[model samples]
Target: MKTSAADTPPRKRVIVLIAAGLSVLLLAGIGVYGLIQGPRTGPPPDNSEADGPAATAAPEDGTQTPGRIVPVERSSDPETFARNVATAVFAWDTGAGFMPLDYTAVVMEVADPTGTEQAGLANDLAAYLPVREAWVDLRQYATTQHLEITDAFVPEAWATAQAQAQPGQITEGTTAITIEGVRYRAGVWNEKPVASEHEVAFTVFVICEPAYDTCHLLRLSELDNPLR
Candidate 1:
């Protein structure tokens, strides 16, 4: 007979609980603060100008060139830390000799030190980067991408979430900032450079100050699904 979820081993049960909690956090913005509950196209090559932000050409030997991977700069200020995290999330080059996970690591380096939120944060990062398969496809085109941030601010809804939370329901120093920016992607097509741009928005949650000397990422809202 099949074992029921309730009858699962203790270790397996904890894993399930963590996954369930992460899902709730990702899907519902309120769950994240309430309980801690928590693309593409255009332009010809412009050889005369700089290759685009973080852009790099694939190696001729068919070997991935490990391009420079810049880790997010840590900051004590919540807004500054959030902005850095947002930039790192959207910055990547398929031809830069790195996979999506490498870029993910850059941001994860500043994730919750307690490790309680790392798994959830990883899931959150996955939604922002290309999967391995897609990365390979884009690599063929020598594609590169980065974000041009227009604004970063604590959303009003965050205030509401905090007010509604029972004292201690939310971690002290934890806050949410909505990031507004334009995502720019550039690549070579038919040996010509092409580029495209789209407005994007997302919320970054972090804990700073007494939690740690520098802000640490906790979670992220769904892409273009940031709190107003």
Candidate 2:
């Protein structure tokens, strides 16, 4: 007898339904695997193995050195000392450059090694104002008169001095000095004044400590009377 739609067996229909479900599950598994291990598109062409982890680099020494804690030295350099003092008083004192220190700090740094008379210099620096219309001596200028100290900060002073030290088309000169078994011939910034504060001029010196460095200018033997 021929089979009709209503006469089809329930067992055969159940087998067909199970086969369709298994086929769908197989397709989903393959898609999931491809998503995870599939070839990457836009990464660097050199990295052919993009499916793996990134590689790291080694240092030039072939090994990494762990960081160590260290300390700083606070001593001074005679050459840098001279330059720093001069910079503090003359050009600009601030930053890695000359630092415009306060009366105490300036006296401490610019003390006369030839004499213990910085106390006197400090007292003298307290005697004048910065707004005067007269010429100030190296020693007196070394000693700041006005303790009002409106602007004795190092960076600020450096900016002020640099602003005052009109940057001249740099000229060239040299000077030599002997200190602690070392002879040095320093290049002086004696170039023509490219600035407004040519009220005074002096040679530069550098002071170095075991751990630090400072700049200063020589104490000029003569003085300029700007008001005259």
Candidate 3:
């Protein structure tokens, strides 16, 4: 994808609830991630289960390149990483020769690293691969995309998992865990419609190795409401 920066159009904006399709990103093993009204604070529950492994302040790769079409650097800060990821999820460039693999590669870069802990990145990738292929096949070209972080809050499930996780161990296998409250828009070029616009509310689920210290994207899902 070698789209010219000048050819990029101003993002067209609209507002609506996220579609059900994105919610299906989760695998059968884990149910859809959801959010509660307000933040919760308390001691770890007796039966609380955690996801993957505990968070670690691992050194981030200091790689940078000009003219890079996609972002692949894993960040030390999960919130910062999430906001950047929200943009990537919504935006694409057909002029730049963007492909589905390019999009998913960036996604994997921000996903929890797979190793001894079994963060389930493989499962998330498996679930998203088909959707990515379908998206590239359907939306042949996209002119512009945009994302806004209207608000952000820890989902109740993730919060609980964090509380329950041991100092060096992150809870794994829970169906809940995500950062909710995002708005997105994109301008797509398709043969049938020729051109189209999409706007929706969505969330990004992530795994934090040590509670909130370090995290990575797990999956993206649509939300009925902004959940602000």
Best by lDDT: 1
| lDDT of model number 2 | 0.24
Which regions of candidate 1 deviate over 4 angstroms? 1-64
Task: Indicate whether candidate 1 or candidate 2 has the larger lDDT.
Answer: 1
Give candidate 1's whole-model lDDT: 0.69
- Model 3, TM vs. native: 0.46
Best first by TM-score, ranked? 1, 3, 2
Q: Per-residue lDDT of 153-224 in model 3, one digit per residue for the tens?
A: 555534443453334233332123234433322333222213332334545555443322356565555333
Top candidate when judged by TM-score against the true structure: 1
Tens-place lDDT digits, model 2, residues 1-228: 112334322212111222333344233331211112222223222122111111111112433232321111122444434333433332211111122234235534544332223443333333211212211211112221111111111222222222333232110111112112111111112222111111232222222221122222222211111001
* Cα lDDT listed for each candidate: 0.69, 0.24, 0.39
In candidate 1, the residue pairs with backbone N, CA or C atoms under 3 Å apart (3 or more residues apart, or in different chains) clash, namely: 25-38, 42-194, 42-195, 43-193, 43-194, 43-195, 44-193, 45-192, 45-193, 65-97
Report model 2's TM-score to 2 decimal places: 0.23
